[model samples]
Target: MSAAAPPVSSRLFSLFCLASYLLSLSYGSTFLLSLLIGSRGGNELDAGSVISAAMLSTFAAVIVSGHLSDLLGAARSIALFSLLLVVASLGFALTPGFGNLLLFFGLMLGLGWGVFYTLGPIIVASLVTPAQRAKYFALLSGSMMTGIGSGPLLGRAASALGYPVTAAFYLAALASLIGALLFWRLDVQLKKTPSASASVARISWHATARVLSSRAVFPIIMVGLGGCVFGGLSSFQTSYAASRSLDYSLFFFGFMGAAISSRMLIAGFVVKRDPLRASCLLSGLMMVSILMFGFVVDDGFSYVLAAMMLGVGYGLTYSVINGLAANEAPSGTTSQSLLLFSLSYFVGVFGFPLLAGRIIVEHGMVTLLLTVLTIALLNWLITVGRLIWRHVSRIKTLQQA
Candidate 1:
């Protein structure tokens, strides 16, 4: 019933295509980091450091960007940050050495990444009404998941083409360029057309804090618990996929291909129905997918299937919870609550995966997978517990009334 729920036209729909592409590039550029390093004579440790650097940067700055989305329009901020990403991609692809690599990939690249994520969800909320957010968010999630799911295959193609890192970086940069342009165009459109529903108030920090502290916090926590499994996959998918002897960028890309396809196809429909329930369902899928992947040895079909399932799980869940936060967020509190949500998710992404990697070292692959499954199971339990609590509380209130 919010005024934001006006009928969307085809042109409005075009905005999603751009979102998908930009997210795809963001993921793609990061996916091929290992190949970039390997091509330049770096070793596994070096590659690990670079990847960590980016994640570190992303986790550290998400809040700042989220807060800043108020001063800077989400669309404009994303566009400008993406421009930085383009430069960083070029820097990593064209430059040399561990220090310079860290400089661009760690700092510039991370900050650019910070911008994309910060603005992305806010803009997503802006595009849809509170009630509609789950469905639209799912669509955007699918687009991003589908695009990035194509990562390993695209990485392989780059490697095969003789300049693996360069090729992938170029494609990612191109995709991002289009995304930036589309975002800019969206900004322009907003300025010129002027929706009958005037814009909501700028995002508010005080409002954001309360939303972050709401009843919805439980679901966000549950998702974070479940997200540990995906975090592991994102970190090691490329390096793990490639030959120990040869840097096969295709390994991770192939895995991404399967994951993205499933997301793009099913995510929108899933969210449209009931985003919260869809996320709950995805928690189950996460258990199955992580369990299946525990057995994957090298870059193979099992790994692909596992990746696909993880993609499904993530695609199914992320935006649902995000939509919930956006919906429950007060009139002017979009960015902060979402920032809190991102912080929770990224913490899992950056920290747990590192733990998993250590598990990979100590416990072996199958055991490591079991760890992931355990994490998923933890999430499932969290969801059930919270739902039960809500149900019981409602029943008690009804009895009292």
Candidate 2:
């Protein structure tokens, strides 16, 4: 007897896991590059600019592709975007010099990342039932965290192979190819039974802009601010450690380890009911973690503890926000909402770090931390305050009517 093949749902789930992993790996690999770019006679701010540029590219792709996914279909769009990842990975591995890295890694690869990250959840959302949304969403986040956690380790291993640093890009390229193949297979499976959502009528650009700018959508946007926090921490943690004479490797180990664990534990709590409540809870934790990052200067234990706090905060925050966005997406604008949510996140991931880099250059890391902390604090207050006010107003209106 032949072995049984896995069901389509299982296959798509696995593909999603692989795609998310590659995305993390690509990002982690770039994390290492950011450090090296500074040491290679380049300014830290310049290196940060490169990362920001890539994210900017991702930002553009996300806004455009979110709507495109509705028209061309998610699986096909993912496969199409994965091809760019593959090419960019190869270019990063083979190209020599900083300018090329910016061209391929920052711009081209960012475009691929924007589309893949935005659509991965949409594809998964279409595959599962409403009851399974939170569970599957958590699973996706877990897979992504695992990949991100391991990416730095993989880059370190590649560096140990006695090859030029570009070899890490080669390793990342191989992973990208694997991801592309997985997405292609997923596309084939999705073609079997077309998703009901696959046929949502395409909204015009003006409508897309209005949905993104609306007040009702602002809370979800606030929830997505976790991306900026995550971005700032990931991009600058190494430098922060160097400034304090702490070990970068140990700090990252603690951060990723805590993040992976927290995501697993928090996954069960992200149910469909009350996703906003979950978002509020996670946002508070994130604010606390950001505060802790400011004091990790002298003691090793504090550094590790701060990393753990950051991990837990970052992990749960992302999961909760994405879940909330999915639940709150409009009847015909689910894809658009998700895209907007992702757009807000990438803006933080890329945009915040870019701003922070400039601040660090002029005022030092202390000022940078203070600035971030202030912003995080304000965001928490506004997010929670508005949510409560809106809820009470809704109740009063219902009673009066």
Candidate 3:
């Protein structure tokens, strides 16, 4: 048998985690793009459309960048995407109108995010053994959550200081530039200490089909549902807060706090021990959180509580489902499986917001919340079903033996 892969360097891993944090910081700051749209005399629909356009770009980018990562290597592909994000963030700050320019910049931002998010887990998977995957994944995600959670606060600080909300985009640009440089350094290190698992190979359509049809389907579907819930909640948060007469920042704070804490504390322990069962429990929590947000939240405390519930539920659930996808992937198709997983998530995260915007403009925030709750319920049911199926299959094998 081939020798076990060498341990990942502590310095290299630290660089990777820091780069992920900075890149996500940039992404999280753009969550305030709705504020910019409102300031420019545009409505929810405009913001949704622009965000949707970006998601569409993200979809395309995930596909292209996956192939490029396989061709050019992960660090180089990530560095290139980081530069694109820098350009988009700068464009958002400099551009005046909320029309084509906004959409173009949004697309650029999506492209950058799509590549970074897809490659991040793949890199972690390559560097670590199967047993260590969940722990490292949690660490990486925690770093990302910290950055994402801090972004809205940064925007709020900018606004408080009488600067335009778009000023956050300038900070985002700076962060992206730094992240790009770090990734470049990572590329140099990778060359000096090449990983055996990091061999460059073209992705085949045959492998892609196998991954989609394999057990990977379960996690992909679950993550997509989680993305839908997240996309709807986040994209329409400003409107929801207005309707509740609450502060939007509370939601971000609660979510960020809960997500980071859960990932850092419980993700490795829970996800490694029967990911499907953990996913089912988390999905139930997610459903309850959505219900609280929709029907039970009447005060700031309730709202923050609801957001925290969602943070733990969806946050841990995502890490669990991601591990499932990576672990369950067919041989020689880990990259393809992750690419599809990212694509499914982008569809829900970006695609649903487009519809949610119109729903809020025409129907109302209540209707939107109700719709999101329904999606969460479906997600829970899927996990429960998968768990049951696994249990029954094991019983059948035992009996036959």
Candidate 4:
């Protein structure tokens, strides 16, 4: 026996694993519908805008939702949010007439994701030990990737079945329903735990304000910036696929699948090692990956490269930052810290792709790719510089002491 591998919370790992599976299923089902819409008549700019609008919804709602979690607690918030997601996804499929795709999708998506973005991490935190976060997060990533990696293939399936974009919406709703069910169960389990049952006074917004202004905030923000850049450019992956004359839905497979798998393996290892150093290394890789996207003249070859690079960046770097943000969160500040971390990252998701959309429409794909390269490189440099500064400062302090 391997000393029984020590005691572990099955509930915590199970919840993360289950949630990951459901969310990926939801991602796969909905993403294909969105792509189908783009294929029908939506231009790259339009498609990009629509997707960004949905992300914008989550971005906008993250803070308030998180703050709410601190008051009502993670389990309740998660339950409420996951329910909303299920309803919204189902209702969106039924919403027939479309005019301003951006406005409608954005509002609905924001509402749905706001709930998810706000509570998912808080729930995970409640379930696991602080030290176990990286490993758990990796497990979550892997589960999600295993499901999400198959998202594009959902499109292939939809296309084969001749399901229109509208029909795909119904399928997405089904996936969301499954995910919501898992979340509901997870919330119930969380509430049953002795740890979660203890009463703590609700966190006031005034104190919340102070927590966000601390030293750790800087590191969190820096990590968030890098995340945002990576996320924002990714918002255009579907559009980029369309531009290449390849199947837009299929393109997601290459990137997301690789990303999901990479994180599954890397998150735990780096978290246990030096999370910050892992972040720096991954940041360099991300910059190289983004820059590599710029030189792809051949559509097929470039996608393969792009997918591998993205997977590596996401697996190694994305995991590092996520782990660090959670690991470094201060007392009574986990909700706020995770939410803020999410907020900055989404700002990238909302802003970066919109910029890319404009670039794709006005400047062209090559220009857009180059622009992504520039932004990613800038983020990489700033992040790297900060890590070096932090390391040197720590060494000097020790020497002086």
Cα-based TM-score, every candidate:
0.83, 0.86, 0.95, 0.84
Give the alpha carbon lDDT tens digit for every residue of 155-187 in model 3: 778878998888888898899899988997888
Runs of candidate 3 with Cα error greater than 4 angstroms are 1-3, 193-196, 200-203
Question: Tens digit of lDDT per residue, candidate 2, span 1-401?
Answer: 01232223665577678777876666666666556666565555766776787776887787677566767777667777777776766765555556645655677768887888888777766666545666777778778777766666665565577666666667777787777777777665676644424532233686566666655376456744666677777777767877888766666777778866765665675554475566567677767777777864477888888777777766766766666566555555666666777677778777777777787788888888887777677667766886798899999999999
**In the order shown, what is each candidate's alpha-carbon RMSD?**
3.7, 4.5, 1.9, 4.0
Candidate 1, residues 129-196: lDDT per residue as tens digits?
66666766666665666566554456667656785556667677777788788887777665443332
lDDT of each: 0.62, 0.68, 0.82, 0.60
List pairs with backbone clashes in candidate 3: none
Ranking by lDDT: 3, 2, 1, 4
Best of the candidates, TM-score? 3
Instruction: Estimate the TM-score for candidate 3.
Output: 0.95
Judge candidate 2 against the unseen true structure and give its global Cα lDDT, from 0 to 1. Answer: 0.68
lDDT of 4 at 167: 57
The digit string of per-residue lDDT tens for model 4 on 165-238 reads 55555555566667766666665566666544232223456645755666556546665566456554555666
